[model samples]
Target: MAALDMLEREPDLAFSLNGLARALKVTPMALYTYFGSRDDLLQALTERLLSGFVTVVDGDMPAIRRVEAWCFAARRFFLGYPQLLGLLTWEGGNTSVAWFDRSVVLIEALQELGFKDAELSRAIIWIWTSVMGAISEEIRNRTAPHSLSPAQVESLDPRLHKPVRDMLMLAEQPDHFDSFFAYHVERLLDALRAIAKRP
Candidate 1:
């Protein structure tokens, strides 16, 4: 946790294994026993993040609800550790299957709507890209005054106000986080449903 916290606070300096080891108060060589190199540590972190999503959703809810929960959990996770955003941008050699497994649940849900494998894959890509793009924007412009919460940032900057308001408009009536998520998920699911109804 300490090493991750350091990395979260200092993205550039924390890119190396030696730096992580020093941050964790362990000898650099000691880290080698657990993770072979910086890349290995990054792979482990990605897996850990994905595993956390599985733990949060736990397969207990309805498919749509699970996706919504996963999105909220994922957003929170990224907000806590924005440094990981860089890792997510690349197609790393050490990608984790666990991440794919979480995505499979959503794809299967789409399949139930009669989407074929290719269609399901495309839907997943589109939904993930939308979610990640929103998250990336949030992280990049996160410097609103301490007095401002995310909700308040819109009101503080006229330029920001329009886009944020637009997103809220895209959300269902009685807009709130739950409604916002449901709105986006419904739109994506509706697209799949439409495809399903086609030949």
Candidate 2:
């Protein structure tokens, strides 16, 4: 994570084996001992990041609650290491198991709520995509603004924040936020339940 942070902060610096070795106060040969190559080091870093998610999930929690916590945990993890999002395209050897286990738990929870296997799979995919897509857009907007002018912000469409804004505003009042998430969860569960009931 430290090496990745340095790379993110100094994109101009060449991120090679020697460079990283120097940054870590180690000889290039020493790094090669632990990681066979530059790609191997990157793979190790990716695995470390993925494995951290497993530690974030509370095994003692109910499956539904665990799913909710996992979603939030994932969001927080991705937000912290936005640069690591690019690593998702590459296949990490043992690191992928954490994500698969989490996904299975989520699917199982939905299935317990009476969703058909196929429908539960689709719902899980849709929910995760929606949340991650929203976070990605927010990160991109905050980091790289196409138009810096004040007029651009003023002229921007308000409709973009309508859904989230409304939710936030309502959630400000006591107990509303809890009710809001519960409402959405129930709606999602009901939809899945309907699919399960379908002949």
RMSD of each: 6.6, 6.6
Model 2 regions lying over 4 Å from their true place: 4-22, 25-43, 54-64, 91-98, 101-104, 114-117, 144-199
User: For model 1, what is the C-alpha lDDT against the true structure?
Assistant: 0.62
TM-score of 1: 0.61
Candidate 1 local lDDT, 34-96, one digit each (tens): 777756766676676555454255555655555556566667776676666666534445555
Which stretches in model 1 have alpha-carbon errors above 4 Å?
5-18, 26-30, 36-39, 55-62, 89-94, 144-183
Instruction: Judging by TM-score against the true structure, name the best candidate.
Output: 1
Q: Please report, as a residue range, the 10-residue window in candidate 2 with the lowest summed lDDT.
A: 89-98
Q: Residue 105 of candidate 1: its Cα lDDT?
A: 62
